[model samples]
Target chain A: MPHREKTRILLVDDVPENLLALEALIRRDDVVVHKAASGDAALELLLAHDFALAILDVQMPGMDGFELAEFMRGTEKTKHIPIVFVTAGGRELNYAFKGYESGAVDFLHKPLDAHTVKSKVNVFVDLYRQSKVLKHQLETLERNRQEQEALLQELTETQEELRKAITIRDEFMSIASHELKTPLTSLKLQIQLRQRYLKKGDASAFTIDKIAKMVESDDRQIQRLIRLIDDMLDISRIRSGRLTVHPATFDLSELVHDVVDRFSEQLAAAGCTVTLTVPGPVVGYWDHFRVEQVVINLLTNAMRYGAGKPVTIVLEAGDGRARLSVRDEGIGIAEEHQARIFQQFERVVSASQIGGLGLGLYIVDQIVRAHGGSIRVESALGKGSTFIVELPVEGNRASDAS
Target chain B: MQANTLLIVEDDPDIRACLEEIMVSEGFEVLTAAHGREALQALQSAQTLPALILLDLTMPVMDGPQFLAELASGRWPEAWQRIPVLVLTAISEPFLAGGVAEVVRKPVDIGVLIDAVARHLPVSLS
Candidate 1:
């Protein structure tokens, strides 16, 4: 154990001579004695330092020992100091009772015995030292308990997060497998149909229109399979931070027009009429193909949710940036789902109603950010939603050039 | 002889067309619906009740379990309740119900599906 500081004792009396004598008799290596010529001076000393014991002379001219003890008892800071009242008065029971009532632990008749005073003072010093040690230990214990509680809470949150990640991964695997199987089944049936036709050994059975229709259906299914695989690949690339963009200058209006034209057939099939509005040739330096993909994803999403409704696409460029907005009149997203829509494998709609891996918006957001752009949604439930994307006109090319 | 009508309830157009063609070639009249809601509507308007129903378990508007509950709840006319239902599903477990005759797993073997249909129909059209 570390060496403790010396215990302090306050020796107060009206006469300086008596204070000196008491200090000389009680002085020891483990104790420090502070002498005061009056009770008021003793209170000043008590205010400045913490003493284990106070030896006071009862018959003093100003602020007598009994009065000082009463004052000390009334004050919060000095009330706990162990007091010993020493006087030359006779050892009457009434006087001793008054001394004890004034907060003195022990009373000594003066012309005091040296050993008796020393022993009584020693007991109080020992108690104060033990209490200080106990308080320090309690503080350390409380701190450690709080730290352990915080650590436990952190561990529980981490475990919950890990469980959620595992669930999403399992769901992704099952959905991907199901999507792949559906196309494979169609392909198998088509092949079986062709084989049966050939087995009949009639070349005339392979008419031009029938062969063309079968080929068209097979191509459509193959495209669906390719789209699913591409989405998976994109997710992996994004997770590994390997998805990169190559910048080239292109007109924003032309790119939007092309993507809209490609989706025209599907939009028409879904009973949706898309109106594209572009002010002029708004040119920008960014990955043309990736930007095209962003527009395509937004348009496809609008068509999926807003089937049989009108969609509007607007492209505007000014103020050192380009903005493209796709508005749809469909069953809009709820407020609670808006924030999570950009996260991987998150979908507000059921997969049975709208078949997708839920990677479309995630990929779109990633590409937009890579081009130094931001995307946001504005909508209310039961009304339609508008997805707005803003990209810097220069498009992070300055860093590449340097 | 009155033709045995088969009802095919499936969401996928390709699968529905394929089954329709196969059943027609087997000499049975076929009617199709995209989901349970559509199937219920068809049943309500039909001139003659189907002898057998080939039901897909998963669909967009309504699913297999919901359809079965509605059918058994006495919502439809009495003549529609006696028709046997054969479930066609990609799911592993069989759907055991009073009206369900059998469960045929997909990708369905054409012969197995046809045989199940023939067994449930009052007259084997083949």
Candidate 2:
């Protein structure tokens, strides 16, 4: 409906006067006429332009009207254009049958009737316009179908991803509930036993040494409960996108030594010894509290899985980056579990009865990445695992999305 | 056979000690293990099989279900099968261990546990 292009007609004749007369008679404001004095000239025009109809003079020097019409029918590009043949022959000569046989839509007699020529040309031009509109509409419909198919594919993929996320969330809730209850169970049983002993007025059970030991055991359970609750809080903070890094200048070696010293009691209880190897003061600008958290998590994991073996901590600074590594010579992660250990609630050692919310490594990874840093692990089954974290010394790198 | 003996298998040291203390106070001989594997070792070397086995489901090396499976595999004496095994677990899901005399969800009620143990013992402590 929006097409504004003029309808074109090509007129070919050896007689220059006849070509001129035909073009003049049919020319209108919305029509364009082209005249060619020979078959070869007409072919050049036909190959260059898309015409609605082609009218050929029957009596020509080399190629007659019938011959030209046959050539047009044989070529792929020009085969669909309607052709009208003009002849000087009378009605008895049966030129109409010959014209139709040569792929002509109609015939015109010389000493041509002006009315017939105008009306016949009009009919063919109108048909050509309708076909052009139909071809455009079909192309638009095919394009729409392809776009819809692409949209459907995109929607299906998004739905599958959402389903997987929901499954992970459900699994996390179950594991969290189980983990939080274990220490509480111990605490509850301990309290109940003591209350029962006191109810019977047993003085021996409340002796100085026995009471001290009970207090120690109570402290251990309380600490475990507090740590589990803290992990859950951190997970919620991360979920709400509130975990951010606030940078400060500090000595990396000093921070590591401080955290390790604090864990001395735990290490001694686990029967594990720490070998700290810091060449010198490795200073950096980073979120001091968050970096301390990373060290604590890594050390805790090393002690838990170290099998009472020696644990090693190393710190080095070079190439504008500080690298920290914690190595444990105990049950190591398998090759298949290395990549998944940092994901939320993904405990590769679930069957081993290791305790915690399984959010330690995930939190560590997040904190490191937010500082524009990286973390990786190298381990094998029974060979021990080493976790390495690298942070920018200047703390000037752009903080990544938390 | 030490029919008055009870074997307490748990992963947590505090909980294991608590159970041992409670059973000892109730006039029963108690043997403790850190995990299923250690419990298995103790059973193999004991002078007499225990009258009852108190098991925790999740443990390092060998868990409760794994221990139950190994116990039912006919690798040990047939009399070991007759010993009532009570599962004490923090898990809320339906337990699937075979040949268990009772399943207690944690935090367990002390009265319920004592009554259940007393009911399963060949000779009542009272």
Candidate 3:
């Protein structure tokens, strides 16, 4: 959008006819010309709108142009506006000299020329128009810069807030782990003792059966709580920027296997077909735990959202980095929400119904970035989605596989 | 398995509680004292000799080094040297090699704590 601009000129002359002529001559679609028969009227006009230039007649009935020019020079507002005088043509040099002394920019003798008047007027008008354009552009640029600075400031504040939140979360996880340890420890002991006693008793007894069911439920709940606390800690490390990757020589194939093995139970429970492919023994030095975590999150998210859909795991060497990708044939990301897929709390609408806290991709992206790596996502609605991770791998070794 | 008694000496309540919980879970009869003075008194007066002492580096009264100095200097119970001393503090300043047996860190991980204690405890559970 262009700047809003308007040019205004104040014309002062005792002869009404002369004022009308000047007005009709200088009128253009872009300029607004105002006429004042008296010096007081001209001053009032100057007070209202900033004039581009003022035209004054020396031989006036009340206050002459020289007096008006002097008055204009005295006041702050009208002073900067250039003043040009109309002379009566006697002691031309003297009249011109006094005009200059009273703040006149130029002088024109009476019996005005039609062409000279139009041409001179056009020069000042063009100057006024150019300056107005420049001023408006400057104001716009300043406004845009201020808005940009405000946005950057807001971003900085949000980053700090997120940091604080991660700290709080870490504290909470550590505390929860401490609190839950006592009960879990006691329960584990109690259950072990109960198992010992049951082994000595009848294996098929009704009361034994009942006790077994209760024990199973209790054990599952304990396991779940432990998993929750552990997840919170890992995610906290990723969020708080405390998670560091220790790059070692390792096999990417083995990494994929570990990830798959960790979620084998969940995959079976979800009854999803999972395929793994890797020619990896790909070498890289990355914080193994964090990279492993990124893969785990991607796979877990896929399993939760993929439903009965097939999920593919691919590990490949690319551009000096070990790459791992998880692609799922499930509901795909929408066009509008794809850009912010890695942002926290932003679950794509397609996966909104899934049981997720929407932190998986955010954590994944963070973990990848920490490895000095990058992640990409490709999706088409209703077809499927693929999430890819690339990382530098130089010195790595495979973790033991069972 | 015979449960050996363990003494914990530290200042922070949160860290103290966390340590006790870990030791108790690992089947040790645990006793806790907050600082070095109280720990020394406990050592002088407790009915049973502890199997190990988990010491913290920084504290208000008679810090870890001072307490260790008094014990290791001379004329002290032989049990002091026998019991494995695991220093658990955040300080990373390198001292003379083998100043203490092992140094665990702050923000204790349960697995690490259990493993450290189990490794240092001399008598294996039957």
Give the DockQ (2 decimals) of all models. 0.37, 0.62, 0.01
Model 2: per-residue Cα lDDT over A77-173, one tens digit each: 8888888878788766445334365443677887889999999999988888888888778888988989998999999999999999898777677
* Candidate 2 wrongly placed segments (more than 4 Å): A5-7, A12-15, A34-49, A56-79, A83-120, A264-271, A334-336, A396-402, B1-3, B94-97, B123-126
Pairs that collide, model 1: none
| lDDT of every predicted structure (CA atoms) | 0.81, 0.84, 0.71
Clashes of each: 0, 0, 13
Off by over 4 Å in 3: A1-6, A24-31, A90-104, A188-402, B1-40, B47-51, B54-83, B87-100, B103-126
Model 3, position B16: C-alpha lDDT score: 65
User: On DockQ, who's better, 1 or 2?
Assistant: 2
TM-score, one value per model: 0.83, 0.84, 0.46
**How far out, in Å, is residue A188 in model 2?**
1.5
> B19-76, model 3: which lDDT tens digit per residue?
6755775678888876677788888887887888998755544667766777776667
Q: Write the per-residue lDDT of candidate 1 for residues A1-402, one digit (tens) a residue.
A: 213766789999988888887887888888889999898899899999888888888888878888888788778898888888887887673254344665546777778789987788777877878877777788889889999989999999999999998998887876677667666666766776666558777576479997886776678678778878988998899999988898899899998988787667667766799989999999999998788879988998998778779999999988999999999999899999998999988888776556567899999999999988999999888799999999999998866676
TM-score of chain A of 2: 0.81
Could you give the candidate ranking by TM-score, starting with the highest?
Answer: 2, 1, 3
* Residue A385 lDDT (model 1): 91
